[model samples]
Target: MIYKSMLLVILLLPMIGSLVGWLIGRKSEKYRDKFNILLTAAELLIISLMFKRIGVEPVSLFIPDIMGTGLALKLDIFRYIFVWVTAFIWFLTTIYSTQYLIRYKNRNRYYAFFMLTLGSTIGIFLSENLINLFTFFEIMSFTSYLLVIHDEDEYAHDAGKSYISMAIIGGLVLLMGLFLMYDYLGTVDISVLSHSMKNIGSIKYLISTLLIIGFGVKASIVPLHVWLPKAHPAAPTPASAVLSGILVKTGIFGIIIVVGVIMNGDIPLSTAVIILGFINMLLGGFLAIFQRNVKRILAYSSMSQVGYIMVGLGLIGLLKDHNAIAVYATLYHIFNHALFKVLLFLCAGIIYMILHELSINAIRGFGKHKNVLKVLFLIGLFAIIGMPGFNGFISKTLLHEALSEAHHMYKTRWFDVAELVFTISSSFTVAYLLKIFITVFMEESEEYRGQYRDHLKKRAIVPMIMLSVVIIFIGLRPNVILKVLEGTMELFHAHGSIEPHFYDIKNIKSSIITIGYGCIIYFGFIRSYLRRRENGRPIYFNPSLRWLSLERHIYIPVGRFLYRSSSVVFKVIDRGIINLVIYLSNSLKSLSGIKVKRPTRVIADLKIKKPKELTRFKIKEEHEDITKRLSKRSMHKEFVTFMDMVTVLRRNLNSLMYAVFILAVMIIVVLGVLVF
Candidate 1:
């Protein structure tokens, strides 16, 4: 009972504190900052207090007659992992934001949303009911949207548009899936649904797919990931840290529920996730290589690292009873990623705080004399690249082993292909991190020498230093987290024990080979083709600017086409029906022996004439006048007025219409499948 009450407090504190902090800031900003730090520290303390309860029975709270089916919250070992990490990272980033946001406008608004997002995210992890989970998921989306647009510039607004549009679409799709599941299975409780899912037939696949896609949007899966690169760079650095490090995991959390708990290791579904995992891995890394912006690169890196986690998840399904290693690897990577990615973003924040720039070309050599910053950045880089002595190496090595196990068991050519992609993706991770480090730290620039030396403060550096220590500590002692991961496997009904030799000869060699591939790619491809000399300094360029964008070329154009096509179809149908009705009325009057009057002007206009006749007779005079007007005036001015109207309507209504169109199409497809 005490644990359950604490659970409610943990969920509500940050939300309540958000209001209190905002009110306090209205009086004094200093005390508000302190209050936020204390609030988050308390959250972390509460989660840590529950650590001793792992491997025991789970804690749950049920509130009936709320949100339709009521709200259900649970805290098992698996959930505890996420809850603890969310609290920890939020605590650190809140501390970091204090110094980082000092010079920025709207500090009160920023901190309010920051803490609100924290509560919402923690609520997502604690949710035992799908509806409850979605409620928190949406809250997190909206609260975080404010953080993304804090800058309120054109760029930030653009990013926020993409972020919110996709989020709303994803949320609606997720809700549809949940509605269907409840209708079919009679409950939305995750535990009950898990068992209920097994009794259903092939419809389960449809349900799971909808759920996966809904979650995948948040996960930043490819094609759905158009918003991430733009969003991370636009958000404040501290917000960026948590956004990349923690929020994407909410998507992953939902997917795990569907794949691991609901599906119970369904092999076919797992195979599909594996294929998409490799695609995300390769695509994210490839794009990261071409990026010149530091935050954009990190954003893509988040995508690629998530791919690794997804692969581990797929392996768990593939291995069935012997998925212990994959389970451990996935959870551990989640933890490790939160640590290092947050560390790297904080490092980026420091640089941004000092220079207000994130472009690699613009900020080259900014950290040359900043040894403390350099060391901290290196720790994060090495961890992410899976250097032998860091936390990332442990999880990554385990993931490699899981892949090997899958290959050995299946012995199929596709798994062999997946293994190659895995190795290349790992190499790409190394290439990009090295690109950032060497360009920003090692390279020499005359413009930034000895600039902003006094900007480094103890408050800013302390959080990163603490992160570095944790990374090193976990890297050295892999068992500390491994034990926790092992205890959570029962949540998935996974059997077997995880007992990999972390420092084995083969694993070390594999790491070295991946590192080697990265070095060659960096020196051979990136340093050569991606840059050029300008005034005796190397300037980097992104070739991908010319590449086709999913949002620009595919999604938007497709949307416009649909809207135009639908408008034309509806117009033709409306006119054809009117003409048919007029003809029928005249024929009925003649048949009844009444005097048949000449056709009315409205009937003649509505008459369905041949295309050329209609054009020649009806539009001929208008066409002639239009041509004369065009000849008398400049073409640009004549067209600009019409185009401006279209552009305004599209700019204002495109996102909402696109979302509605997608929802409509999804419903049509589902209905067609069901009817057929």
Candidate 2:
């Protein structure tokens, strides 16, 4: 009984706490910051206490049936894992934000949305039904967009637009897919859907595609990833940390539910995921290589890393009953990436907070002799680049081995392509991390003479140190994470059979090779070919690659086309075709000799009729009822009135932003009926 209430508290406390934080935030930053930290810490304690109570069997808390559908809160081994992951990160981010956002405007608004999103993210992890997952997913999107647009600058607004637009498009696509799912399956419960999904046949593929594309916008799979790179750089540091760290994983978590759980390891969809994932990995890494903004580089790296996670997920489907290794790899990497990525973003935030600049050329020697910041940055760097003793090395090795096993099992060319791309992308990851390190931390004093203040507050350093310590602990004793990962196999319906070995000869050799390739790319090409010395300073020379974006080539054109399409659809199909149908119906009735009148109720007994004043057409008389009907002299006035109304609507229609709002509301309502 106690355990059940704790689960609800874990889900709702952050939300409740965030509201309180907002109210007090207007008073002072100290009051607001302390309130949020306390609330988040309390939520973490609740989650911790519930940790032991969540047994092998799933525990569910139910709300009353809402319009024939019930809301559920289930704590299973799957949700349990992410519950801890999210809370831990949120707690750290809160601590980091306390000092980082000091004196920054809108602290109240930032903390409010921050806490709200924390609750929404946990809800997403704990949801037992798709309706519940999506409900929280929408809340998460709305709250996080506030974080993105918090700076209230033009860049922030632009990124916010892209972020919200992608989220809405994804939601619509997902709702349409889910409508078909609920119509055929009769339920949105994962446990129930998992049992029935096998019988849906080809419909499952369409459903899978829609859900993937929908989630892909957030998961940031290639072609659907234009918003990610933009939004991360625009958001404040802690917000950016969570955005890249955990928000993206919520999308992967949904995909896990669909492909790994509900769909029962659908093979065809798995292949498509693998193909799209490989493309995303390469494209993200390629773009990251040329970026000048440190934050954007990290953002693009997130896309690549997420693609790697997707590849691990795809491998799960291809491996079948042999899916244990891939499942472990994917889950482990999700946690590992969240840890290192958050640390890196916070470290970047510290640099930004101090230096007020983010370009590689702008901050050369930024970490000079700052041992704490340097060491902290290196820990994340090594972890991200897959150093032999870091957390990333273990996961990437497992991921590579899993793909290799799948390839060997099938003897197919595609798996070979997967292996090759994974290797190349890994090398690129090393290259960029090395580039940052070389530019910011490793230049000789003679080469770069400028230096800035490096002394940092303990508030900023503590959270990063905590993250670095965890990354190293896991890197050294990976069995801890490997054990946690074993619990996730039941969710994916896989064997927790194979014991993972991180320090083996094969793993070590692969790490060495990947790191060596990364060094070569950094020193040979990036330093010499892509950068040039101008007036005794190093300048990045890859403007072509930096500006060459999918936004210009693909997303903008598609967005414009969609806007134009909606107008054409409204004028030509909605009004034009619908009006034509009514005309045809009336013409058919007349031709068939059936008198059709507008259906209405009128008095048959009462003798009410038009007044004589209305019937008398006295055009010269001022009281000719010209306001009620168009008398001959008032024809021009009536035409002018009608034209004014039409013109007003037409002028407003030029904006078309309302169409987007209406379309979004309509989709939500439609999905609401299917769920609630």
Q: Which candidate number would show the highest lDDT if scored against the true structure?
A: 1
- Model 1 CA RMSD to the hidden true structure, in angstroms: 9.8
lDDT of 2 by residue, 1-676 (tens): 7777887888889999888888887777787887887887888788777766664566788886742477788887677778887888888989989878885888888888999999999999988888888888989999999999999999999999989988987888787778899999889988899889989889988887778767777898877788998899899999999999999999999998898888887898888888887888898888888888889999999999998899998889999999999988888899899999999999899888876778888887777666677889999999998998899888888898898889889997877777788888999999988888778877654433444444477777898999999999989998987776666777788985677677999889988898898888888888888899899778886665546566676566655655565556555544443344334534554455342231232212212122222221231231222322332332122122222222233334433645654574555543432231
TM-score of each: 0.87, 0.86
* Global lDDT scores for all candidate models: 0.86, 0.79
Stretches of candidate 2 off by over 4 Å are 66-68, 444-455, 544-548, 565-676
Worst 10 residues of 1 by lDDT: 600-609
Model 1 segments more than 4 A misplaced: 570-676
Query: Per-residue lDDT for 95-208 in model 1, tens only?
Result: 899999999999999999999999999999999999999999999999999999999999999999989978977887788898889878999889988788988899899889
